[model samples]
Target: MKKTGITLCLLAMSVGLTSVVSAQTQLPNSDFEDIQSISGVADNGGQPYNYEYDSLGQGWISGNPVNRYLEIDHIFMKDTSFTHSGSHAIVMRTDSIGPVVAVGNAGLGEFVFNESNPFASIVFGAPFADRPHAFAGWYTYKSVGGVAPSDGDDRLINGDSLLILCYLTKWNSTLEKRDTVALASWTSSETVTDYTEFMIPFNYFSSDVPDSANVMFLSSSLGYVADFSERPFGVKGSTLVIDDIRMHYSGAGFDEYAELNGTAYTVGKKVVVRLEELPSDASVRIVDMAGRNLVSRQLSDKESTFELAYSGIAFVIVRSEKGTLTRKLYIH
Candidate 1:
């Protein structure tokens, strides 16, 4: 409780300091406020299958269930008359959570529903011109097994997980990819019964300002489970609700660690952070609660320790070719 509370407080205090350079263009219809149809009936093998309205035309794409594999979206995960912010929120559900097996995915850019190659369900990058620091949103999740789905010796335990992906790209038209600038992925199996805030902090892969971005949201992390030849997917009947998604330009900085000398500490103090398996080029920065950089260093070893200075609830943003990790640190 202390950890969660303290973190939330710091976030609230730092909101104004992390200035938004330019308003991140909201992913077209991100709030799920445009409800063309709350309920709809679709044809499935000439059978009447009931479904809710999805955000296909509202800047999202999914599989061609009629001709390809099965896919759908926005399963009334929001409260009956309540919304996270606007008039509504986006909902994603999987077949694992219910009697039906539906792939619930929505993302910026485009989705290629590959029938022959499920792995080919590649979501191409979208035109994005901003270099925001992170992706922010609120979400809630639910599942039956209460465990993340796992695949083992030819069997599945009906696991379900949520996936959020943000990739910075250079837009290579020849190979049909962003050329890879920076990327972040969040995959969790834990059931979140409440709407929780989340941020996808950007970690540059190549220092190049990405000309395009690709972001994805999924109710089922394992999209290939039904193929039966790939890794096992998670349980069915899982659902997720998302709302108020945004990308930010700045905030002085945020904290990611909360221990100094192995004891609870206040901000604006000093502490040491130890990380293992770091690449030689790994970049680590210590930022104040206002998102101000205080310390910066580059790692040249497999394992290293950083003595952070001037910290009271400071954030340690570590960037490597692999990915970025942010830990909260507290000092007294």
Candidate 2:
């Protein structure tokens, strides 16, 4: 159905500003300076640097082997004396230390071991409530080969690529569990020599603000695909050094009327359309393909729920002095 005449004016809309968001929050131990044991130290030297660590302190979590791949586990994550800024920097590697090198390679995230799969679900995320414009960090990648099509850089693993994933999830009342509200991923080419600063931009999937989030940093992209049965095709000695990671947020200070998330809404269900203030002349109508009006109603209030008894295809029209907006919806 063609929208003939309409103007959807939202009068005096008001949107609340969360706050001034120029401040950037640095996550705990983001500098890779704090060192704690994810896996208890095998040997205690003395005090501060007494024991070796497979992981670090703070909320960071690392996946360490439980004796299956002990030889490869310790080398995967080493809190070495190497300093990007302070006493230590985190080093992750697909080292050639095990029977099958790079098989039990390491990555870090906020996760834990799963009961069904002892070594699975390795990294879990922490609660990150806000969305950042960019994720800024410093990292260096050193692998064997080039990141070219002809140069053994398959998406899976070859020269060994580094991956960092940041996810924002929320508990959905309908879904009954936490779900992903937004995500940002960073994949590095395997040919970086000096420590380079990186800025990863987020491509948000949903407009919904997130609840808890998870992050994953891996030295090799294909380390655990075979579940330690065999090594991945990535270079054995690939290494990633990282430090000084932080989240950057910027928000515009303003107020505006709430617009629909999209033009489409699922039919036969209560769909909430938000409005800060309703226009006095605002009107809504649903029409069939034959130009017959199915329902016509005056809209009021900051929130309105719409539902239709008719099934099949229809065009929902909202009109005010501003203009008309036609939305095609499939009713079931």
Candidate 3:
């Protein structure tokens, strides 16, 4: 139930400009290793003038409202004990002070808070022009069964869910608005005790090149209702720990092979891949929308078919020494 109206504010300012990146790019501070303390107190009498707040490192932004009226800080915290790699990771938790439940969220862009109307608008996205095929990362989630808001989506009433999402956008001069070129989103309610890898493929909506990219992680997907009220939605204890986020780009060899010699299609609950001449070291992997690998095997023949046990949107990936190619599939 996150609001999309705030995206209109992005038109007022130009984000940091950078050279167009074409290769696979790992976001700055993707590992959450750089920890820094940002000291600030709420401006509208939310806290004492002497109070200070610790925030995330550079290249990441959060809507924790440390400078706002609520002044919630527990939404984002540094975690060294439960990390996937390196010495640090971030744990985003659904936090509440009194009846105000703030959903834990961190992204790549900046946020603007209007203390007058009490509206927090986020200008989400950083300058980038790459059309990466997939967004990959590692994370662990622990959900505390909480009731969804009365006006929220019914599907989330059972419990809170963690969300990871990325989108590519371009400002359309003709339309005078931002156009979403591609998007990849994943949400899960299951409790994961150990860190698990995830790769979500972007679904292209337009053929136009992108000028900005945004990636975000949220501890509770149904906590948006608390934005305008002091009433809580999701449980305060639900948490998500994440580390090592990266973007996946298609290699040249994979592109050439796909255009000339390979083809992939879905038939019912199965995926069929055909390569005129399969490489000896090539392999095929099938993953669901949640980035869970369902099938992986070496390519022994020019044409191979794999039966899928689950049905939904899936990705068919072929990997070899030449490169990696991915195809989107829809199985009914």
Candidate with best lDDT: 3
Can you write out model 2's per-residue Cα lDDT over 1-332, one digit (the tens) per residue?
11011001001101111222223444567786666433333443563322233346665655432222234434223334444566666666665433333422322343433444333444454545676766667777776554433344464434556666555566677856555554445555557877788775443445666655556566665443313333344555567777778775655311112333324366365444444456688776665432235667787764666776666655566655544444556677
Cα lDDT computed for each candidate against the true fold: 0.52, 0.50, 0.65
CA deviation > 4 Å runs, candidate 3 = 1-19, 40-50, 65-73, 116-119, 146-157, 225-232, 251-332
Worst 10 residues of 2 by lDDT: 1-10
Clashing pairs for model 3 are none
> TM per model?
0.57, 0.55, 0.63
Give the runs in model 1 whose Cα sits over 4 Å from its true position. 1-24, 38-56, 64-82, 96-102, 111-115, 118-122, 146-159, 173-177, 224-232, 252-332
Q: What's model 3's lDDT at 44?
A: 47
- Per-residue C-alpha lDDT of model 3 across residues 71-161, encoded as one tens digit per residue: 4445445456688888767777787655556667677766665444332455456777877777888989988875665576464567788
How many Å off is the CA of 189 in candidate 3? 0.5
